[model samples]
Target: MIIAQQKPIKEIAAMIADCKKVLLAGCQGCVAVCLAGGDKETEILASALRIMRKLEGNPLEAVTYAATRQCDPEYIVPMDDLVKDVDAVISLACGVGVQYVAERYPDKWVVPALDTKFIGGSTVHGVWEEKCGLCGECILHRTGGICPIIRCSKSILNGPCGGSQYGKCEVSKDVDCAWQLIYDRMKALGRLDKMMEIQMPKDWSKSRDGGPRRAVREDVIIE
Candidate 1:
């Protein structure tokens, strides 16, 4: 899931300093699970902003709504009535959600309330770790399900990189050497021979180097 962290209250308040009214839009998607931007978070932010504005004698009229998802047009469509009355919209979703709201309401001022983090999952409560580099390719088959691209500090394709020591990365003792993990996992599975095969350099074009990317499933199109 896409992880995100909320921006500071002061910074968020500054974005709509000139506006008397604003909508706090939240998403019940990835941000909800991560506890950043969800229905409850949206209300919390709105209340905080209202209190701050009241304290400053500016008194903002903050309203809020949580969409099932901000990335999809269908979910955003329901916000039309709410957008008509607000001076600006503060999206409490990821970067994608912010853009979706902006695109849906072209004339309304749209601002992001969260900083989009990486593709990751929680290790425990409140701790999220990045697992995929989103290189636009999958190489897990070659690496025993451990992603060297992201888990490896250096993003090495075939490596313990001469920098591994005591099963830890050279960059930090706290960090595990990704290659070491890969070697151990493969060996345990009796698939150590897979590591001996050289991996080709990643194709840069498959990732961000190629610019904005899109995936379309023709079968899913209603038209």
Candidate 2:
């Protein structure tokens, strides 16, 4: 899932300082799971904006709405009429959701309300840690399911980098060495021999730096 964090209240205040009317659009998707831009967060932001602007002697209007999923056109379609007259839209979703709204409503000004952080899984309630880089090439099979690219301080391929000390990352003592974890996991599973195998250089072009990536499936395409 995409993890995001809400912008600061003061920063958000500046985005709508000149607008007379604003829409605080929320999504019940990834942003919701991260608790950054859900219905409750939207309401809280709307109220804060209203109060802050009122105190500034230039009161403004802030309307709140929570869509099923801001990334989906079906969920955002109903907002077309709503945006017809608003000054701007503050999307409380990830970058994808923000772009979807912007592309669909080219005439309206749209601003992002959250910072898209990473693709990750929650460790516990309210705590999310990144686990994947989505590099388009996965090596989990040989790496004992541990992602060295994202978890390791240095994205080393074959083994721990020279910076690793005492089975911990040199960059941070709290961080467990990704290669060390992989070694232990693979060894315990009777797959330690896989570690000695030389790994080829990663093809980073498959990831975002190459260009806009796309996946096609003939079975899923409509005529």
Candidate 3:
């Protein structure tokens, strides 16, 4: 899932310093799971902003709403009436959600309330770790399910590199060497021979280097 962290309150307040009214739009998608932007978070932000504005003698009318998903157009349709009277929209979702809201309401001011983190998952209650680089390619089959592209400090396709020591990364003592993990995993699975096969250079054009990317399922599309 896409992870995100909320921006500071002061910074968020500054974005609509002059507006008397604004909408706090939250998404119940990935941000909700990360505890950043969700139904409750939207209300909390709205209340905080209202209190700040009231204390400054510039009272604000902050409206809060949480969409099932801010990324889809169908989910955003419910917000039409709520946005019509608002001066700006503060999106409490990932970068994609922010853009979706902006695109849906072209004339309204749309701002992101969270910093989009990365494609990752939580290891504990509050700890999330990045596991994929989204290189637009999958190489897990060759690496025993460990992703060197992101887990490795250098993104070496075939390496423990010269920097690995005691199964730890050279960049940090706390970090484990990604290649070491790969080797161990392969050995345990009796697939060590897979590591001996040389991997070709990654085609980076499939990644961001090729600019914006899109995925389509022709069968799902309705004419």
Candidate numbers, best TM-score first, in rank order: 1, 3, 2
lDDT of each: 0.95, 0.90, 0.94
- Model 3 — TM-score against the truth? 0.97
**Cα-based TM-score, every candidate:** 0.97, 0.95, 0.97
Model 1, 1-223: lDDT tens per residue? 9999999999999999999999999999999999999999999999999999999999999999999999998999999999998999999999999998999999999999999999999999999999999989999999999999999999988788989999999999999999999999999999998888876778979889999999989999898
Model with the higher lDDT, candidate 1 or 2: 1
- Candidate 3, residues 73-185: lDDT per residue as tens digits? 88999999999999999999999999999999999999999999999999999999999999999999999999999999998887899999999999999889999999999
The clash count of every prediction, one per candidate, is 0, 0, 0
Q: What shift in Å separates residue 4 of candidate 2 from its native position after superposition?
A: 0.3
RMSD of 1: 1.0
| Model 2 ranges with Cα > 4 A deviation | none
Candidate 2 TM-score, C-alpha based? 0.95
Residue 65 Cα positional deviation in candidate 3, in Å, after optimal superposition: 0.7
TM-score of 1: 0.97
